[model samples]
Target: MSDMPPKLAEIVDEFASAPREVVLEMLLEFSDEMPVLPAELRGHEGMEQVPECQTQFFLRAEVQTDQTVTTWFDCPPEAPTTRAFAGILAEGLAGATASEILAVPDDLYNRMGLATAISPLRLRGGTAILGRLKRQVQEQTGTPT
Candidate 1:
């Protein structure tokens, strides 16, 4: 896997080291930790939907002047697994620099051992989330693709 920001790397390591059953549990915990979007950002113009996911998942990312990134996610409570993926990205990548977000490997979830616990389709959704996050980072940072 590529070098990830310290916080995101820590989360990936946590999942990697966890037992199969615990991985799912930890994912759900992340779902619970998912923050609601601030009222002003809710339904904002820049938010984009990830069509690859079975459930509706929308996200918006902002790269600050200092290059730190802030990501916002909207997923229904009923889609705990999808919400968990968003939670992981939001919590892990929040405040991470654009370069750090860009460096994260596309297949980091596989390294986390999540494949053993979640469906292949769900894992694909996770990959889509990361893809969208990276695109937003590049857009905000004005980095050429």
Candidate 2:
């Protein structure tokens, strides 16, 4: 995580050190803390859908003129795991630059020790979320992957 954004690295460290039971509980907490989508994006029609997730999940990421990233995510409250994944990215990667977001390792969820707490499919979905987010940042910023 040496190349990861500072805030994102911090979150990863926190999860990496947590016990399995605590990881699940902390994941739920992240779900609860996820920000609501802005009114303009509430429709979800323009957002990218994360089909890997069991529940409906949509996200949009914008790399701003100032180089800070702003992301939006939409997922049902009942889908705690998926929502947690979205929340973690939304909060952790907030204000990161394209390079910082892209530098995040592909196996980040696993490195966070999430593999033990969540099902493999759920972990895959979380990985997909980060992958898609990074792709968007790359596409928008014209940064080479």
Candidate 3:
């Protein structure tokens, strides 16, 4: 797997190093940490949905003047697992450069050992989330898809 941004790498390491049972607990903690959308984005006007997710998950990425990327997620609280995945991405990739975000491998969740804890379909949701995030980064950075 490709080396991820430092913050993200730390999260992946945390998951990879934990016991299988602990991974679910850690994921739930992340769910609680998922940041709320800013007031301006509350209505989900421009955000794109990850249809692969079992829950209604929407996200948007903004590339700042400094070229750092900020990602926002809108996930229902009841969907803790999906919300946790979004939390991981939001916290891990916040303030990372667009190029850095784009460099993240598509199978990062697998590297984090999530496949053992979640269903294959849930893993697909995580992958879809990463796909949309990367796509937004590419669009913002003028990188060809």
> How high is each candidate's TM-score?
0.94, 0.96, 0.96
**Candidate 3 lDDT over residue span 1-145, tens digit each:** 3546899999999999999999999999999999989998899989998999998999999999998988899999999999999999988997788888988989999989999999999999999999999998898889997
Can you list the residue pairs that collide in candidate 3? none
Off by over 4 Å in 1: none
lDDT of 1 by residue, 19-115 (tens): 9989989999999999998898687557899999999899888888898888899999999999999998888887788999999999989988999
Candidate 3 minimal-lDDT segment of 10 residues? 1-10
User: What overall lDDT, based on C-alpha atoms, would model 2 receive against the true structure?
Assistant: 0.90
lDDT score at residue 56, model 1, on the 0-100 scale: 88
lDDT of each: 0.89, 0.90, 0.92
Model 2 worst lDDT run, 10 consecutive residues:
90-99
Go through the candidates in order and give the C-alpha RMSD of each one to the true structure. Answer: 1.3, 0.9, 1.1
The CA root-mean-square deviation of candidate 2, after full C-alpha superposition on the true structure, stands at 0.9
